[model samples]
Target: MIESWRWYGPFDKITLPEIAQTGATGIVTALHEIPYGEVWPSALVASRNGEIRAAGFDWVVVESLPIHERIKRGEGDLSELFANYRQSMANLAANGVKTICYNFMPLLDWTRTDLTAPVARGGSCLRFEAAKMAAFEIHMLGRAEAEADYTPEALQMAAIWFQKASETDRDALLHAIMSGLPGAFDRYDIAGLRQALKGYEGIGRADLRANYQRFLDEVVPAAEDLGMALCVHPDDPPRDILGLPRIVSSGADITWVLNAVDSPANGLTFCTGSLGANPTNDLPALARQFADRVHFAHLRNVRKDPDGSFEEAAHLEGDTDMAAVIAALLDEQKRTGRIIPFRPDHGHELLWDAEKGTHPGYPLIGRLRGLAELRGVIAGLRHRD
Candidate 1:
C-alpha cells in the first residue's frame, strides 16, 4: 500500500516538510483555494505538484475535486458545472495525477457534535452524538420535520438535553457540526443551516440517489477517457442527517453507483471509519467484495453505541476488525498488482498535538501513531502471506 497524508494546502498547521518526517511518501491534497464550480487550471495543478515535489514528496491523490452543490442537487446550470468538473479532471490527468476523491453529500461534507470528546488515554477525539444533533435540529435550527426523523423517546431526550445544555455547549455543538473542522467547504450558523436545509426540502433518498447516478453518468466516461479514477467518499456517519438523505452509506448504495456507471474509472474511497459507523457494514467483507473498485482508502476506527452515537477510537482498537480488513486489502493488492493508497484517517489530539492545537481530527502525533500502527499491520500480513 502507498502510505499518504492529507494536507489542507499551504494554510494547514502541519507544513509539508513536517509531514515528510512522519515517513509518508505521498501527499493526498486538493486545491482548496479554488471555488467549487470553477475549472481547476492545469497551471495551478502543476504549481501544487511542484510545491509537493520541492518538499521531497509526491502528490499521489487529489483528496477531493469537490462536486458543486448545484451538481449534487441536480439544480441550476448543471451542464456548466459538469463541464467545469470534466475540465478539472482533464487538467489533473494532464499533470499526471490520476486518483480523485470526492463526495456527493448535500449540505456538509463530514460532521461531528464534539471536537474534543475525552478518551481514556487523556487525549481528545472527535465524536458524533445523535441526540445532540437532534437537539440542534429541533430546538436550534428549528427544523419543522425534525421530530419525524427521530423516535418519540429520542426527541424527548434531545429536548431535555437542549434545555440543560449551556450556551457554550450550544455554540460548540453548532461549530462542530456546521463551522469548525476541515472540509466543511463553507461555514454556517443557525440561519445559514435553516437556509441550507431548505434547498433539500423536497429531495429524498431516491431523488438524491438519482441525482448522484446522473452525476456519475456524466462524469465517469470523462474520467475513463483521461485514464483517471474517481473515487466517491461515503457519508460520514453512513446515515441521514438534518432531514437530508444520504445516498452513499451502505453496500446496496455502493452497488447501485457502481452499476449505475459501470466503469473502471468510477470507484470507491473505502473509509472504514465512515462505513463502520453503521454496525451492519461488515468491514472485511466489504473490503473483499469491492476490492477491485477501491482506488483510495481512509483507515480509522470508531466505537459505536447502540443509540447511534460514536467516537473515534485508536486505529487498531475499535469495533472494526483492522487485522481482517488489512488481510483482505493485502489479498486485493496481490490480486490487482496495484499499490493501494491508504491513509490513517481522523486521529485523536494527543501528545504535543493536544497542546500545539491542530485541525480537529488531524493532529500530527496522533496520525503518526496511527500510520506506524497500520504500517506494522501491513508488514506482518505480508510476512504471513
Candidate 2:
C-alpha cells in the first residue's frame, strides 16, 4: 500500500509542506473549487497536479470527483451531467491521476450526530448515534414517517434525547451533519433540506440500486477507455439515514455494483471506517473477497455499539482487526503486484490538534498518529506476509 493523505486543495488548513513532513509521498485530493456537474477543464487539473508535484507529493487519487445528484437520481439533465463527469475523468487521467473515489448517498455525504465525541484518551472523535440521528430527523427536521424506522424503545429514547437537547446543542448537531461537504458550508436551511428530501420521497432501496447500476453502465466504459479506475466509496455509517435509501452498505451491495459493469475500471474504495460501522461486515474477509477490485483504500476503524451508535476509534484500537485487514491488503498486493494507495481515513483530534480547531476527523496530529500506527502495522505484518 502506498501511503497517502487527503488534502482539500489550497484552502485546507493543513498545508502541503506540513503534509509532506508526515512521511506520505502521495496526495488524495480533488478540484473542490469546481462545483458538482461542471467540467474540470484540463488546464485546472494540470495546474492542481503541478501544485502537488511542486510540493514534493504525487497526486495519487481524487478522493472524490463529485457525482451529480441528477446523475444519482437519474433525473434532471443527466446527459449534460454525465458528459461533465466523463470529461472530468478524462481530464484527471490526462493529468496522470487515475484512481477516482465517489459515492451515491443521497442529499448528504458521510454524516455524524456529534463531531466532538470525547475519547478515553482525552481527545475527541466523530460519532454517529442512531438515537441522536433519529432525534434530529424526528423532532428537529420533522421528516415525515421518520419514526417508522426506529424501534419503539429507540423512538422513546429519541424523544427523551430531543427533549433534553437545548437549542444550541441542536444547532451544533445540525451544523455538524449539514455542513462539511467539499466546497460547501452550512448553507443547508430547513426548507432546502426538506425540499431535497422531497426529491427522494418515493425512491426506495431498489430504485437507488437501479440508479447506481445505470450510473456504472454509463460511466464505467469511459473510465476504462481512459485507463482510469473508478472506485465507489461505501456509505458512511453504512446504513439508512434521513429517510433516504442506502444501497452501498454491505458486501452484497459491493458485489452488485462491481457485477453491474464487470470491469476493472469499476471498482471499490474499501473504506474500513464506513463499512466497519456495520458490525456484521467482516472487514478482512471482505478485503480479500474484493481484493481484485479495490482500487483505493481508507484505513480506519469505528467502535460500534449494538444499538447502532459508533465512534471513530483510534486507527488500531477499534473493533476492526487492523492487522488482518492490512495483511489481506498486503496479500492482494503480493498476488497482483499492484500498489493500492490508501490513507488514514479519519482520525481523532489528538495531540496539538486537540487544542486547536480543525476539520472534524481531519486534524493534523491525529491523522499523523493514525499514519504512524498504520505504518507500524504494515511493517509488522508485511514481514510475515
Best by lDDT: 1
lDDT of 1 at 20: 92
Candidate 2 residues 72-169, lDDT tens each? 67786688888888888988998899999999998788898898889996888999888888888899889858888777777889999989999898
Question: By TM-score, how accurate is candidate 2?
Answer: 0.97
- Tens-place lDDT digits, model 1, residues 304-340: 9988889999999999999898888889889879989
| lDDT: worst 10-residue window of model 2 | 178-187
Off by over 4 Å in 1: 179-185
Q: Which RMSD does model 1 reach against the true structure?
A: 1.3
Name the 10 consecutive residues with the lowest summed lDDT in model 1: 178-187
Residue 77, model 2: lDDT of: 61
